[model samples]
Target: MTRVLLLGGTGDALAIARALPTTHVYSLAGLGRVPGDLACTVRVGGFGGIDGLVRYLRDEHITLVVDATHPYAAQMSRHAFDACALADVPLWAVRRPAWQPQAGDDWREASDWREIVECIAPFHRPLFTLGREALAHLHDIPASQHWTIRCLDAHPGNARASIVDARGPFDLAGERALFDAARIDVVVSKNSGGRATEAKLAVARERGIAVVMLTRPALPDADRIFDDAASARDALQHWLTRP
Candidate 1:
């Protein structure tokens, strides 16, 4: 009986958890609302660090690990890589495909948050769709620049005056309404390519607003990499069936 440890925090993670064997345990970082009941046992919160994860894996006899977290969740992925290696447990990563710029999409790629902050001075009325964790990098933005920031939770930060507490699955019409209402001059967003939040990019293209897109941080190489939920589930099943 190979007990599994699953790192989950996204829609893909949920889907994978649902598909996992009953002996597996699902874990979340406990950042957002507690997820609905998963198919397997669920645990929320951090695993301390590499040492903590290694201990848990050994103690619980976890034979396999699935890293199905957000692409931006580089720290957790790194920890999982190291911990699983130390514990001699197999690990897999499931990544959603990133959004590529299409024709007519005015995308300016920034290597990181520092670069975006440095080059974004010209765009005064900016709309920030970057997640809350990345907001700290924009603290240096000049106070003169009025920013429209959106997040799932209310962020009490001094860098931005306008903060909208909202979650997405945002439609084109809603994005258009937000852009028009905000009178946005530019858009700054992470290349977190998924259907849940791509509407703003469409609206930006439609309005001719410049977009400063931040590239995703690199993740450690995994024993396996999957681009979709179905493929990942199949791979996990194969691994489970092996001696």
Candidate 2:
């Protein structure tokens, strides 16, 4: 019998997870919310490391591995790649495309947060969609700047920064309201290309605010890579029927 292991955390992962058979396993790192509704078995927490993951793949008899993690989750994705290769099981990745800058957008690519701070020097109010990574830099905030960070986890912001705990699939109107209310003059975001959380980019364009985009980290190659969840699910279904 064919068994699947889904390495998931993003919304794309949830979509693919929904189509999984009861025998397959869906794994989460216990970051945000664990869905109480997945028909497939849900495993929380890490697999220790590459050695541990290899043991799990063989022990669970997982024939195939699907990586539907976030684009920036390079470490987890790397572990999956190595573990699958060691276990001699095929690995497929749901690798979403990165966003491209459109007309009227003032976009600057930053290699890291230090570069981001330098690029955002001219802006007074900056909206950070880079999640909790921004929270670490609250103490570094300049006297002339105010920071707004949006993340899945809720935290009472410090004196210089405000944290907006919310999930995505955000609409343009709401993004506009957020920008207006925050008096945003710039945005800091990762180039995570998806409809969810993309409204902020559109709003940035509309308001003519500069965006400091974080460059995506390099990911290890997989046996197969799917750009979308639906296609990955379809391919997995086909794999299940293979002799």
Candidate 2 has what TM-score?
Answer: 0.97
lDDT of 2 by residue, 68-172 (tens): 999999999999999998889999999999999999999999999889989999889999998789888888899999999999999988888999999988999
For candidate 1, lDDT tens digit of each residue in 195-222? 8899988888877788998888999999
Please give the distance, in angstroms, between residue 110's alpha carbon in candidate 2 and its true position after superposition. 0.4
Q: What are the lDDT figures for the candidates, one per model? A: 0.84, 0.92
Error of 2 at 23 (Å): 1.0
Highest TM-score scorer: 2
TM-score on alpha carbons, each prediction: 0.89, 0.97
Off by over 4 Å in 2: none
